[model samples]
Target: MSGSGLSSLAAAMESAVQDAPGVRVQTDVLIRAATAIDHSGPGSPDWRARVAGAIEELVAAGLVECPRTKAGWDRRTLPELPHWVRRSAPPVAAPRMTAKPWHHLLHWVPTVDSERRLSSAERGLLDAVNRWLPAADQVPVVPMRERSWGLLGDDKALEKLRSGRLFVPGRLTLELLRCRSTWPPVQQRVLGAGTWLIVENWSTFESLCTAAEADGFDGRIIFGSGNQVGTRLAALADKGDTPASPVLYFGDIDVGGIRAARLAVTTAQGAGWPAIRPCRPLYELALASPHRLRVQPASADTVSWTTAWIAGELGQQVAMCLTRGEAVRQEAVGLEILGPAPFAALVADV
Candidate 1:
């Protein structure tokens, strides 16, 4: 056998692909196996270059074919792999245990990109959690300070932690530090005496802020910043010395909005807040608004469980929208919908 690292890697790649059913091998599968025997750092540039080079060599030699797409490599139809290399022993087959709770949690969390690539800190946190998950009596806790390498100060990691992932409790020890010098020049209103309201759309957020300020309502509005809510909202709602107050989420009447509401409530509840719910009046208004568009439903494929968690009327409306394949934008409500009086009326009893 050749002594070159690429030679051994190529051989292992061939053997693994040959042993696999249908001669199919995913990029991650090959890279992971190569990492086990290749003796390279997990995400080092040199290691990635070596893997890429070996893959390209295999493609050139007609041993593998990775079709290209406009976006990137198309792994779906990766061509048949050749069985040209020999291995000393067959790959081990282990009994498949039921998926651990963390496995399902990861599916719900947005830790990785479309390519399933994690950042250095995210990978560190995930690996550490995997090691301690089985032995964890309760939620496995990690300090957020610069104690060791893990996803602590990382915003995305904290957001995911707040999403009710029980085995990995990173949100408890996390504190987001803000320096006046490094701030992004965005000014957020400080609440004097009010409940926190998370607004998903930028336009709606601005309108609500204006309305709340003018109406003299005791409601503090925070922007959810689209799909990635980040850690600011969670920090304000969960980490402060102020008393925990009710949380109300107001977004579009579409599936996306419902999902956002669900995430907001779950994160708040996980942080120990007791009263978190969607603004019933705003949600109902969107559902019943006559300004609905005929656009295709964004999340029509799967029925969501948000209906069970929200108020009966609002939840039933969300369920009805899904069943009828309807999506209502927040713009349907317009700026006038949540004017001072209406906004005050929305949360008056809560």
Candidate 2:
């Protein structure tokens, strides 16, 4: 066969394989396609020999594979063709290279973009960081949202800084960003006290505050404002004026409440403070109360941890309550249930 004829036959086979549903093409289909080419007439006896030669060339070049059987080619006679041929592995493209704006941010660049270029939002963030880093020392401490709004024109831009999505430089610390946690409202009964009590619900907080104001409770009383306690627990460390205390948490006896308490414990420990523990007396009071609300069943881990935290009969009861998809809100144990000197009485017991 002429060089152009051989090339045409090979091209036909390639097109047949490409047009097929999958990588593999039947040997007869490829041969039929090659025979259809202008160089090889369908009625010609030597067309199979030409097709077989072209297929061998493609197989030798690694353009296709014959997994079932190898072709045995002979110039004198028609070559043996395999049952099927499959397209070979495609070449892998090299990673796109782009110039980095800062050497320090080499690892921080996102790889999602095909062009290896920063998006408009990312560029804006980098620009803000550049402006802030040069004069970071000169600026006074500000709220995170305030700083975020001023720099990125979006108050929530820096919300994910600690979430690992954004790569902030080691030098550009949260302290420098001044992203302080919003400390919950507190009612202090004792001056320079180390022990503190945190209540979750608003009504419960008000009840606790009333108790604290009446000298019914020692130490300080804080309003956790629900699950926000987990994130804001770090503020206890930020407020240097306050003494490190054994923080006690009281909240709803539900999945969210338990998770929040767990989160607060982890966050407090991470901040070098003592682990937050449950306000046992308050929880027991709430559990025993007639008031009960339907709640989603908690996971085994949550139930197990709640049992472990409370311990013994009370723990088992709490676990059973959780299993039954029932919860006792902290509001159930209000001033009426707790009495005016509830914390003082509990303190005496301790």
TM-score winner: 2
How big is the RMSD of model 2? 23.9
Model 1 regions lying over 4 Å from their true place: 1-187, 237-243, 295-304, 340-342
lDDT of 1 by residue, 58-168 (tens): 553556655332233431221212222222243244323233455433453344333344444454565555554454454433443322334354534533543433234
> What are the RMSDs of all candidates, in order?
18.8, 23.9
Candidate 2: stretches off by over 4 Å? 1-142, 146-170, 174-192, 241-243, 340-342, 345-350
Quote the RMSD, in angstroms, for model 1: 18.8
lDDT of each: 0.53, 0.65
Best by lDDT: 2
Clashing pairs in 2: none
Q: Candidate 2's residue-wise lDDT over 191-260, tens digit each?
A: 2264677677878878777766566454776667667775455565556534465678888899888877
